[model samples]
Structure formats: structure tokens, C-alpha cells
Target: MPRFAANLSMLYTELDFLDRFAAAARDGFQAVEFLFPYAFAPEELAARLHENQLQQVLFNAPPGDWDAGERGLACLPGREVEFRAGIHQALAFAQALTCSRIHVMAGVVPSNQRPEDCHSTYLENLRYAAAAAAWQGVQIMIEPINERDMPGYFLNRQAQAHALLDEIGSPHVMVQMDLYHLQVSEGDLASKIRRYLAGGRIGHIQVAGVPERHEPDVGELNYRYLFQLLDQLGYPAWIGCEYRPARGQRPHATSEGLGWLQAWL
Candidate 1:
């Protein structure tokens, strides 16, 4: 059976950073993931995880300014120093929590910046980050955010993500196949999964309903069928629930959308 992990970042905004682990546990989630964990102390976060007996599947290296629209800049020139610092901060937390995967955010490119230039920088940064993560048995995943949500973000498609990963040429570096973003940027979610699964290029998976970007059933994507396809492929990782609820209600609201998942498990 595939283990399901809740992304506390989007699910339960009502809870504090440390409380998310316990909330997920109480909600019947065996594992959890988040976008960033820089504000919390590593030792403190580790204690919470230990007390709850939850596994930390994924977390992101901090992007420069999430609120200011900086998003991420892993491929931007002259930002390598800042990028390495973010990696170190995440590594500290990962070591304490025994996490095995970290998502590297690819920031948006300026209107004038050339794709070739950004692509080159991305490959270089990924190579460096991958080597650092390899020492701790951690895999670094690069996600392609959809253009609708992120106006000028680089890497908005699976094919582009795969190509970047191939150029990086490191087993430690792989693509984060986010279905929601893929649905917006490119359709045929199941076919894309098949392609990446066949090539062994996918490192992590995240899902949300398309159009509304809410819980699975509230939107266009057929998550029940998607989960079935994942099962057919024999995927053994967590399917991260990375979506916002229709309102500020409890994370359980989204859990209801997952009722079909129980059938497969």
C-alpha cells in the first residue's frame, strides 16, 4: 500500500509549526511534509516528530522571500551564496528529523533573462546541491511551478523538469512531479507519470485538484484514477496532499476528498 503524507503547510494553517506533526498524526496521517521549516528550531522540531512517531518525507530549502514574490532563485546568477545558506539551514533540520528528501525551488526568471542562461545556472546549482545532499543520504528534488500561479517562474512543465534533471546527471537530483501544477501547465497527468516512472526520473509526488487548486474531488482531476495508476506502477513513496481547503476549515475537510483512496489501500 502507498503511504499518504499530508503537507501541513497548506492543510492546517490553523496550527502552529510544531503542532502540525501532532495534528497530522491525530488525523491519521503516518507521515508529513512541508514547504519550508526555517523558522522553527531543529532540535525542537525533532522532539515533536519523535513524540508523534511521524516520518518527515519532504521539506523545502528556504526561498529568499516567499511573501515578497521572490519565490526562489536556485538558478539566478550571483545568488549561489544565498542558495548554499538555504541548503545548510535545511540540512540541519533534515539531519535532526532524519528526512531523506528536500525540494529545491526554482525561482522565477526576470522578463529580460534568457532561458539558456537560466538553464545553465540551474544545472550548476543542482549539481552542487545534489552533492551536498548525497552526503546525508538525502535526495534533492526540483519542482516546476505552473505559470498561472507564478507568472514568470522557470520550469513550468514536466518535460522541462526532466530535461533539467537529465542535464544535472545525478541520481541524487530528481524531479518533483506535482500533479496540480502539471494539470494547469500540461494535461495528461497519468501519461506524464508513466513516462517519468518508466525513466526513473521522479523523486517525489504532490497532488491537488486542478482549476480550483483545492481538495481532489472539488476540482477537475480524477485523483481516484490517478492513485490507481500510481499503484499500477508500484510506486512506494508518499503521495503528498499539497492543497488548500476551500475555506480556513480543518484539514479533515480535505481528508473527505480522499475517501476513494481508502478503497485502493
Candidate 2:
């Protein structure tokens, strides 16, 4: 069976960020992921994971100033210095937590910038990140968020993600494929998995129900079949459960609402 990791950032909204670790474990999740971990001390977060026996499967590098609307700094033209610093900070946390993957978000393209210009900068920054991460034995992941959820985001399609990977030519850089985004932007999930996973391009995977982005069981896609497909292809990475609990099912009712994962387990 494919292993599943709870996305604490999106899943356990009812609890505080630090408390989500234990909540995930109590819900029968063995591993977990999140958007960012910079606010807390790496050692403190490590202690939580050790105490709960949970693995930190993945987390994103610090996206530049989220409230100011900076989704990521990697694609921004003049933030190369800030971007590199963020990578080091992420590595420090990953090392303390024993996490092996970090997804580097591509920032939204500014209205004044040309797509080609931004993409060129993105390639260079990813090249730097890949080399730095490879030295520390951590893989760099690039996720393509759908335009609907993150309009103007530089990376938004699987084909574009793979093509960029080919150009980067870094063995350590891989695709952080989010199924929800793929379904939104490009609907042929089965065909995409067959081509990408079979070829070993996918480094990590995240899933949620379509339209509502809730529990996978209620989604338009047959996630149960996809889970089987992961095993058939011998894809061994963790499948991050990056979704919200269905309405009225978060916080106090989390564990009971985990029926979908219970079925898989």
C-alpha cells in the first residue's frame, strides 16, 4: 500500500500549528507535511515529531511575505539573495526533522514582468537550490499550482513542470505533483500518472477531493484506484493528504472523520 502523510497545514485547522503534530498521530497518521515551518524553532518541531513518532515527509521553503502577496521568491527577478537564504533556513529545519523533501513554490508573475523573463530567473534559482540541497542529501521539489486557486502563479501545468525539470537537468530536483491542481488544470489524471510516475519524474504527491477539495472518497476521481496504481508502478514516496476536512468535520471531529484514510490503511 502507498503510504499517506497528513498535511497538517490544511487538515487540522481546528488545532494550533504546534498541536497539529499530535493531532495527526492521534488520527492514525504516521507521517505529515505542511506549507511552511519557519515560525517555530527547528529543535522544538523535531521534539514534537519524535514525541509523536511522526515523520515530517515534506514542507515548502519560506514563500516570500505571504500577507504581502508574495507566493514565492524563486521566480521573482531580484530576490535571488533572499531565495538562497530561505533555502538554507529550510535545510536547517529539514536536517533537524530528518525530512527529505522540500517543495519550492514559484511566485506569481508580476503584471509588469514578461513570462520568459520570470521563467529564466526561476530556472537559475532552482539550479542553485538543487545544488545546495543535493549537497545536504535533500531533494528539491517544484509544484505547479492551478491558476484558479493561485492566479498568476508562475508554474501551473504538469507539462510545464516536467519541461522545466528537463531544462534544469538536476537529478536532485523533482516534481511535487498535486493531484487537485492537475485535475483542475489538466483532467487526465490516469494518463499523467502513467507517463510521469512510470518514468520516475514525480518526487512527491498530494491529493484531495475535486471541486470541494475535501476527503478523497467524496471526490470525482477514484483515488482508491490511484493508490493502487502507485503500488503497481512501485512508486515509494509518501502521498500527502493535503485537503480540508468536510464541513463540520474539522477540529473536535477529526479522528472520526478520517474514514477515508481508515479504508486505505
The best candidate by TM-score is 2
lDDT of each: 0.83, 0.90
lDDT tens string, model 2, 1-265? 8899999888778878899899889878899999999889999999999999999999999999999989999899988999999999999889999999999999999998888889899999999999999978999999999999999999999999999999999999999989999999999998899999877879999999897888888779999898888889888889998887786445475565678788677
Instruction: Give the range where candidate 1 is weakest over 10 consecutive residues by summed lDDT.
Output: 256-265
Could you tell me every candidate's TM-score relative to the true structure?
Answer: 0.94, 0.97
- The TM-score obtained by model 2 is 0.97
Name the 10 consecutive residues with the lowest summed lDDT in model 2: 248-257
Candidate 2 at 115: error in angstroms? 1.5
Stretches of candidate 1 above 4 Å error? Answer: 250-265
Report the error of model 2 at residue 37, Å. 0.6
